[model samples]
Target: MPPTPPSTPARDEARIRDRGDACPGALRLHAADDGGLARLRLPAGRLTAHQVEALAVAAETLGDGRISLTSRGNAELRGLAEECGAELAALLAEAGLLPSPTHERVRNIVASPAAGLDGLGGPEVQLWARELDALLCAEPWAAALSGRFLFVLDDGRADVAGLGGDVTLVAVRPGAGQEPAARQESAAGQDPTAGRLHVGGRAWLVAGADAPRAALAAAGAFLDAARAAGNGAWRVRELPEGSTPDVAGALDRAGIAAEPVPPAESLLVHAPPLAPGPLGTASFHVLAPLGRLTAAQLRALLPAEEVRLTPWRGAVVVGAAPGHQDHARLAALDSHGLITRPDSPWAGVSACTGRPGCAKSRADVRADAAPGSARGLPVHYSGCERRCGHPHGTWVDVVATADGAYLVDGAPTPRTALPDAVTTARTGAIARAATPSTPAETTR
Candidate 1:
């Protein structure tokens, strides 16, 4: 009813690519409307307070005094000087952020931020995140992957399963635990590491596919598919049906057994979105009004050892205790304007940079996208039709069409009707969010 939870559906064929992936990296910068931009990859978005502080200092001293969170769970430093690559590189290198130069861009990985801390999702996926990352960086051939290539390690909670990943591995469990009704028939067995594998258009029931093996096999499968396609396919979803990697064969070749999931019973995989606020009493998840965070906001997270940046423009602040977060420290974050409670409307808002930051933008979306007014669903304000950072699942899409008039998910609406439409959409999404059958639906 509420845009029935998504499945791992076959996507439309992608066009061939002739050039390199222009995605920015810590050393390689992109010239944007504002200035040079550098992206730092954080596998699973795991970062220590020291690492976070290092990034904050670099942003304040070398860039625009701001650090932006990305949908890939990465970090970006913009407004950089033309010749600051050397300084930026040196700083990041010392902080151990750049593990490998050749594979930095290809290190696009996202996992459940609350994997273990939330105590609901299966398998502590951050463990797999590191092992897989190490394997990727060590394999020279992996460097050939396009910067846009992505891998998802969902913790069976569905938080990041539907970010349209090139390769996805999700934990399998039974009973009702945040899964949509559509998923009941296809729910796999209870295996912390073993789960269904989605590589491009095909699905496989993998055996012995732990994080390390699954990650390696997925990468190998893509390489085989890409080579067979020979059309510059950068992602598994890009290859035609003929070129869809024989994931089963790849796993077998890797000594990882995998059987074809019956097409009818393959996992439905509903990826619900994670709400911003304290997450399940184990940790405090907070978000900025917008995706961008100034150095001061980042500093506010300090004295806290580790943090995980989510694709949804927020973070999970874990506690030193066995299964709880430090309330006082979380309160400090709340003081700094982070949305630590679900009731705060800032939890439901996001906007892409417009105006001075993006030349193609027709409107300054960030200027108009204010938060703190509670909404049931997420609202994304886009400068143009591209909708660069909209929610992955159901949401209220506010796209700019003119000075005041706009489109709500493509239908034209008067400026006056915008709020009502958004409210209606949010109401539906809120109902879905509260439904026990829903799953997490964060973006890529």
Candidate 2:
């Protein structure tokens, strides 16, 4: 393991100002270089087989035949025409993808990718997830939440909780020491009856409520405090003056049961390339080469086994047949360069369409940072300062500037020679220089 770096003083923490996050959604689209971009938030990253099929149809009918998975466990429709927004929204609504137009953007929820896989925490987590979703939709005021605010319902395994959710509902084993389901107790003892429900890595006690109701109340309380802050902050952590919701207090007020506990380590669901599930599977996960699926390829996936879009930048097709042309389906995707191995360079590398696609781009960064340019590390290719679509986990950042590019590993480095610098990066060679001004000067 890399040596744990010394704790660095917070520098950028105070630099951010509170403003409504301009996170795009299906109803509110962003105009990008390619065209219009529509982000469909999939709470818990869970979608029924029907919803997945509808997404595919929406991708084909309304926007470009391509779909991009987001770090937030959401789906994005790219290259959409302006006129198609309303029509696409209606289609999504019909497909049950959009339950509430008013509360659409606030529905950012993510759960364990393998919640039910191998019988981890299937019924309980799924039940809790549904309860939380229903509660969120029922609250009329939840629409005020920024699209970026996130909620995580973990099965005490910490898979999704570790992704930096503002509010979390973790279900521990029933027999574990839990806090008494009541408020007004002193905050001293670890409530043995209430399993921990952590927020921002800090645990809190829920006094009278179960997991589902406690989570819903916790979210509501966070929103209430966020709005009271009156600074346009969307997430609980973003509230100024430490004004975020108090998990324990909120649970107390809501009459839910909870108690504080240390943050649990979350596991990344890193499934390797595997065979497609049984045929006629309802929900399906598909892996796209470079996350770019062609029109024809997508068409073939139609009438698919169901789909659960994953944050790992892959698609999960549930309910497919055990041997449903597994080799052929994966082979076809491989032909398109979408390999599912974690060792593949493309597995972690991401790039924003630079130059021709984006007007703000100063260089064709994507062309320079192609698959050949990848060096067995998570490197992002950005055209300018706004590094769109960067990786979420630990990664090697190769951000381009006008003069050259800036290389950021654990420590920052400057590379004047772009191509050679890439090669040096692959070899773990550290090249340092004063930050360059031009793109070429930044190369190796």
In model 1, how large is the Cα lDDT of residue 338?
80
* Candidate 2 deviant stretches above 4 angstroms: 1-19, 119-123, 174-195, 205-209, 262-286, 298-305, 323-329, 371-377, 404-444
Q: Once all C-alphas are superposed, what RMSD does model 1 give against the true structure?
A: 5.7
Q: Pick the candidate with the highest lDDT.
A: 1
Ten residues in sequence with the least summed lDDT for candidate 2: 435-444
Predicted candidate 2 versus true structure: per-residue lDDT over 293-324, tens digit per residue = 55555445534444555555565555443455
Rate residue 115 of model 2 by lDDT.
Answer: 56
**What are the RMSD figures for all models against the true structure?**
5.7, 7.0
Candidate 1: misplaced stretches above 4 Å? Answer: 1-13, 173-192, 207-209, 280-282, 320-325, 371-373, 402-404, 411-421, 428-444
lDDT of 1 by residue, 182-236 (tens): 3423333344345567765566655324546766777887887788777777777
Poorest lDDT segment (10 consecutive residues) of candidate 1: 434-443
TM-score of predicted structure 1: 0.85
